[model samples]
Target: MFNLRTRDQIRRVETGKSTSNTTNGNGSTSQFGFSSMDGERQPLLGHQATTTLHAEPGFWRHLLFSAKSSPGTNSPNPFVRWPAQVWNVTKITLFSSWINLLLVFVPLGIVAGELKWGAPWVFTLNFFAIIPLAAVLSFATEEIAGRLGETLGGLVNATFGNAVELIVSIVALRAGEIEVVQSSMIGSILSNLLLVLGMCFFLGGIYNMRGQDGHGHEQSFSTATAQTTCSLMTLASASMILPAALYGVLSQAEEDNKQASILVLSRGTSIILLFLYCLYLYFALRTHQKLFEPEVSQVSDSDTGEEEHEPLLGPWAAALVLVVTTLVISVCADHMVDSIDALVATGKISKTFIGLILIPIVGNAAEHVTACVVAIKDKMDLAMGVAIGSSIQIALLVTPALVMLGWAIGQPMTLHFETFETVAFALSVLVVTYTVQDGKSNYLEGAMLLGLYIIIALAFWVSPTGALGKV
Candidate 1:
C-alpha cells in the first residue's frame, strides 16, 4: 500500500517546499504547464507557480475538504488545519481527548468509594501503589501511538499527557504536601532525560551505523543553534538554583524566613525562564521554516489523497462522554500521587530521589519514543530538538508551575533548588549541549550521555539530602 514514489511525494509535501521548477525544457514544457501561445504564459501558470509556505503533506486534504464543507461558526483552527477540525465534524478527536480525561480520574473514584469503610490499608494501597499503574497505562498510550500516525497517534499522546498533568496537579494542591508532589515531579524529569533520551540515542545510533552508508548523516551544528541556546538557558536556570538555595541557607541566620523566601525567588526564576524559552521556540521554529533543507523524499511528487466521509459518532453524545472522562481522569491523578507516595514511604526510599529520576521520564515516554522514530526517518533536527526542547520545558515550565500552584493553595514554596539537584542539572545540560552543539552525534556521544546519566543516578542514591549532599 505504501508506494515508494507516492511516499516520496508525501515527504516533499510534508516539508512544505519545492525545487525551482519555474522553467521547463522545451521537451518537458507541456509537463510543467500547457502553453496557449508560442510567446506567452502557460494556461496553467496560475496553478504551477503558486508558492505556498505552509504546505504540509496534508495541505490538499484540508483544502479539498474545506472546499466542499461549509465552515461552522464554532470553528477556531481554520484553513490549512481544517483537517484537525475534521474531528469536530465527527466524534474521533473529541472522544479521544475526553476519554483521556476519564482515564485520569477513575483511580480517584475508587479511592473515594473505599473511604466509606474507613479502611487504612485501602487508603494506603490507593496512595502508594495505584498511581504507578496509571502512569504505566499513560505510558502504554505512547507506546501504541508510535505505531500509529499523527491523526490518531499524536492526538492521543498530547491529549492524554496534558490531561494527566492537569488532573494530578489539582490533587497535589489539596493534599497540602510539597514533599510528596515535588518528589514525583523530579521522577518525571529523570524518566525523560536519562531513560527516554538514552534509549533514543542508542537506537538511532545503532540503526544508522548498521546501514550501508559509512555513517548515518553527519549533522551540521548551525542548524540547531536555537535548540542549543534553549538547552543552555535550561542549564543557566538550573545552575542559578544552586546559588539561590545556598544563598537562602547561608542567609538563614540574618533572616529566619529565608526558607520561605527561597520558594518565592525560585518561582520568580521560573517565570523569567519560561518567558525567555518561549521566545527561543518562536525564533527557532521560524528559522526552521526559512533555512531547513529537506531530504530527497520531501522533493518528489505524490498522491496521498483519499476518499473521505463523515465519522461514526454524533455531536452532543461525543461532548458529554469527553467532559465526564476528563473530570474522572483529573480525579484519578490525585489518587495516583497518594499511591506513589505511600509506595515510597513503605519502602523507606528517598521520595525526592525517585521523583528527580522517574516522573519526567514516565511523563514524556511517548515524546521520547517519537524522537527516536523520527531520527530513524532521518529527521535529525526534530529528533534532537525533542529531547532538548522537552528538557527545557520540564526544567523551566513544569518546575515553576509547581511553585506557583503551591502559592495558590496558601503554601508558599520557593523556586530555589537544592544544591545537588542544581549541580546535577547543570552538568547534564552542559555535557549534552556541548556534544550536540556541532549538530552531529555518534553512538559515542549517546553512550557518554547515558554514562553521565548513570553517574547522576548513583549520586542521587548515595546523597541523603537529595542534591544537598556531596555524592
Candidate 2:
C-alpha cells in the first residue's frame, strides 16, 4: 500500500533519529525504534503520524488484510498495505475500466468471427478482447506471486503470466501459422525486455525522485535481479544468434535439407533451453535464496507485537482465478486465430505486422500495466522481476515448449527467423543486459528503450510486400 509519513517520521527514517512514545488522549503510549548505521537505537519523545495514501470502496480490506486504516481515516495507520495500494489505484482508474470496457468486445468477436461477419471486424474485436483477459491473467499471477516469496513469485509470474503467448503460439502452430508463432514469440521477448522494462524504469525514476525530495529514501536495486537477468539474456542472445548464423550458412543450399537442418537445430536447442530454465529455477528457489530477498525492515506491529507478513490472496483462490482467466484467454485466442485466415485473405495486413506488433502487444497488456504500476508504487523488485522474468520465460520456456509441441503436431516450428529479426533479438537482449548491469534504472534509460521499440515496430510495419519472407 502507498504510505505518506509525516515530515518528522521522514526525517527520522533519513537521519536515524530516535522515537519515543507520547501519551494519547486515552493515556496510552506506544514505543517506536529507529536504527542508525552504527546499529544503535535512540529514543526521542513524541509521535509522528503515518497515513495510508489510497483506498477503494470495499476491496481494500481483503487486499490489505492487516491494514488498520484507509486513506484519510482518522484512525492510526499501521502498515503500508502494498497490495491495496497497487490494486486500488490500478482498479479505480485505468486497468479496471479499461478491462471492463474491452470485455464487451469478447462476444462481439465471437459472434462476428463465428458468424462470418467480416475478417477485419472479427480480427479487431478479438484482438481488443484479449487485452483485458490478459490483464486478468496478469492480476491473478501477481496475486499468486504475492503468496509466494520473490524468487518463486517471479518464476510463477513469468511462467503463467505468459500463458497467453504460449497458447497463442500453440494454436497458431496447429493451424500452420508458423510465421505468426515465430514472430509473436520474438516480439514477446523484445517488448518485455525493451518496452516493459523501459516504462518501469521511467516511472520508477520519477517516483524515486519524489521520494528522495521528501524522505531522502529510494528503493534499492536488486543485485540478484541484475545477475540473473544478464545470464538469461546472454543465453537468449546466443540461442537466437546461433540459429540465425546457422540458417544463413546452411540454408543457402538445398531447400529441403535446409528445412530439415533448421528443424533439427531448433529441436536440440529447445531441449537445452528448457534444461537451463529448470536449472535457473533450482538455483533461485533452492540454493542462493538470499540474493533475491526483498530488503527487510524492522517495523513491528504495535498491537500484535510481531512482524507483519505479506497479505496474500490465498493459494486456492489465486489458482482458481488463474485457471479461469487462462481458460478465457484460450477461448479468446482461438477466436482471434480464426480471424487470422480471413484477415490474411483480405490482403490488408501482413502476418509479420500482426505477430511482431499487434499480437504481442495485446497479449502483454496486463503485464505491461502491472509492472509499470508496481514500479510507480516503489516495488521495483517486483517490477523488474516481472519484466525480465517474462522475457526469460518466453525465450527459455514458451518458445521451446511451442517448438516441441509443433514437432509433435507435425508442424515442425523452427528457430530460423528472418535475418533482421534475429539481429533485432540479439541487440535487444544485449541492450537490456547492459542497462541492468548496474542494478539501477532511470527515466532516460526507459526513454531509450521505448525509442528502440518504436523504431523496431516501424521497421516491421513498413516492410514492403513479401519482404518478411515465408516461414
Candidate with maximal TM-score: 2
Against the unseen true structure, what C-alpha lDDT does each candidate score?
A: 0.47, 0.66
CA RMSD per model (angstroms): 12.7, 11.0
Error of 1 at 435 (Å): 1.6
CA shift at 41, candidate 1, in angstroms?
40
Q: Across residues 29-84, which tens digit of lDDT does each residue of candidate 1 receive?
A: 22121122233422111112212324555445433332211112123334523343
Query: How much is 109 displaced in model 2, in angstroms?
Result: 1.8
**Which runs in model 2 stand beyond 4 Å of their true positions?**
1-98, 141-158, 210-220, 297-320
* TM-score for each predicted model, relative to the true structure: 0.60, 0.73
Global CA lDDT computed for model 1: 0.47
Best by lDDT: 2
Residue 307, candidate 2: C-alpha displacement in angstroms? 9.0
Model 2 agreement with the true structure over 32-94: per-residue lDDT tens digits: 222211223111101121233433343344234322212322124323434433333333222
